[model samples]
Target: MEESTADLIRAQLRRLRSAAGLNQEEFGKLVHYSASMVSAVETGTRPYDRPLLARADEVLASGGLLVSLLRIAEREGQPSWFLPWLDAERLARQLRVFQPTLIPALLQTEGYARAVIRCDDLLSDEEVERRVAARLDRQAILAQPDPPQLIAVVDEAVLHRRDERFRALMVHQVEHLIACAERPNVSIHVIPLSVGLHIGLSGPFSLARGADGGWVAIMENQLTASPTDGEADLATLSARWETVRNEALSRQQSVELLKEVVKSWP
Candidate 1:
């Protein structure tokens, strides 16, 4: 489990209880939680499992419905591993994504995602379904009534390197990008290879604004993710995101560039 996310989930639960003016025992009784359970969860001494937390949300009436947490949790599958980062991402009011080697995950078309997922020869069909379902489910965050502001910066090379089938998929993907770019909550920028290596070379990262006004940074390698919630680390990621954003082409420019790429598709 990511320590950062674990702490954030616990903090949010504690805040909910405190706001309701309930002590641990009282809150426990309301949600059928044991006092020890409440204490353990709050202290991050126990796993902050989603199902348990969802029941508590019902008792507390947080309206985020706790089920949202569960959904986000299920997406990761390995709760003990990615829960913290997922929790922080779920609670964020804004998300900034920077992808240097691939299309932004949230914006991937079904076809594109299918091709990429198929490349994972180790994944059984069932495993691929599970992963793809999770990825698509995460896109729901963008459609919530109070969805986060999403700003994405993608590397241009992802747009140019594709086979015929992938090219067609990318054409659809770029159209989808154009539509998303029209939303007030979404902004997409493309990092042209011409500009060459920027701060994002550090790695793919997302900076999410937590409900508590703190920022959380998520870094992902091939199969694992790490989160940094320390103010200092968040500041560093935030600065890098800003630099990447500045170096990327504007949304209009990106759309134009994408149009030109699609035209050259064979």
Candidate 2:
């Protein structure tokens, strides 16, 4: 089998770190990441993103070599269909998201994301890991110096669903949600079960507003996610977003609800 781009990059990272006589802890400090993150990238359990690569390149004096490999790995790792949405997400100034069944991807913890992706069963282990890494990488935007405002409204059911098998995962996921909600740029709202039914029940979707004031919407289904800049689609999704958001608890209340849900988990 051919060595994947990710595998090659991992090898290069490991080789360079060894040559520098630095352990994972030392290298992680130089790059402003945790030692575990360095290990994960070196072990190929987590995918490397542009930010990590750029940091490593500068710190290791690799002359952009590490950053150069990120493009190739991203092209190979990410599905072509999702590229447009990724671009939009990076460029957007504000994002409005609605998820009826599960926690939105942007706010999901690694364990929860893995559990969610593993549900397909048909995906090979390699593919599942690749996807989980990609999803986590996308989340870096939120940690940027000037992250876009993210308003996420989820159905209360998303928090209430429980299973003995995923009990720990759910607890961690909810805890992560509370942490995210505390960020000034990130707001999480939940539509209580008391609301019964709402327009958002149709599916999960997101609207991204760019600096130029134009809006793009992405709708997700089982097979793929579709991005649209059509006026009609934007108008419809915008209205649905407003409706669901109005039905959701305020940010403070949502945080309280999330805390309550976390306690109820086990």
Candidate 3:
């Protein structure tokens, strides 16, 4: 198999770091990242973004070689609108998500992700596969040594998806959710159907608090998604998040609910 542009970049980074006589720990300090993050990038477990690449280029005196490679890799996948949100997500210290109609992208199983992407119908099979791969790649953040706190509030209806054709897939997805919820950095809460209608019905959105303490948010619609750091937007979404979270079942209750819902999938 041919190596992807991303793979090539990772290999080059690893080679360059070694030539600089810097171990992952020593190099990461210069780049302002954790050693584990440097290892993740070199090992192809995490996607390299522009900032990280640029910093590495300067730190290693690569004369912009790393950043140049990243430009090529960025063109290979991911939509333009999603790029900002993706960067924010990677740098976030805390992520708060509200999903009314489906599982949050970060927590979706591969099968569920493919199904959701395929719903577009307009996309070719190649595009669908590319998107699924990108979505799965985004999940690597959860495994980082210093992962962001991910608090997700989902509508109970998302788990009770009634498509018979997807029954088994949904079961596996819910089981994946149960496993994710067990992680200390992850919290999954479900808003019961008993709540009837609520503010979360507006749409799905996410807020990410970066390491610098600044917050940014992404609002998703059927056609596209956009990210914002404006005060007004943040304020409104923050209020909605608080309201939806309040309506959600406790974490323990949500996990129990997930277990029960899995049994109902058949």
Q: Which one wins on TM-score?
A: 3
Q: Note each model's CA RMSD in angstroms.
A: 8.1, 12.5, 6.9
* TM-scores for every candidate against the unseen true structure: 0.73, 0.72, 0.75
- lDDT of the structure predicted as candidate 2: 0.83
- Give, for candidate 1, the lowest lDDT window spanning 10 residues: 72-81
Model 3, 1-266: lDDT tens digits are: 01356567778899899999999999999988889868866774444566777888888899999777656555768655665577678768899999999999999999999999999989999999998998998898899899999999999988887889999899999999999999999999999999999999999999998765778899999888978877999999999999999999999999999999988665
Q: Which residue pairs overlap in candidate 3's backbone?
A: none
Model 2, span 1-266: residue lDDT tens: 01355567778888888988899999999998789868866874344456677788887778888767656645666654564466668767899999999999999999999999999999999999988988898898899999999999999998876778888888989999999999999999999999998899999999888765667789999888888777898888888988999999999999999999988765
Best by lDDT: 3
lDDT of each: 0.76, 0.83, 0.86
lDDT of 2 at 5: 58
Q: What is the Cα root-mean-square deviation between model 2 and the actual structure?
A: 12.5
* Runs off by more than 4 Å, candidate 3: 1-74
Better of 2 and 3 by lDDT: 3
- Name the regions of candidate 2 deviating beyond 4 angstroms: 1-75
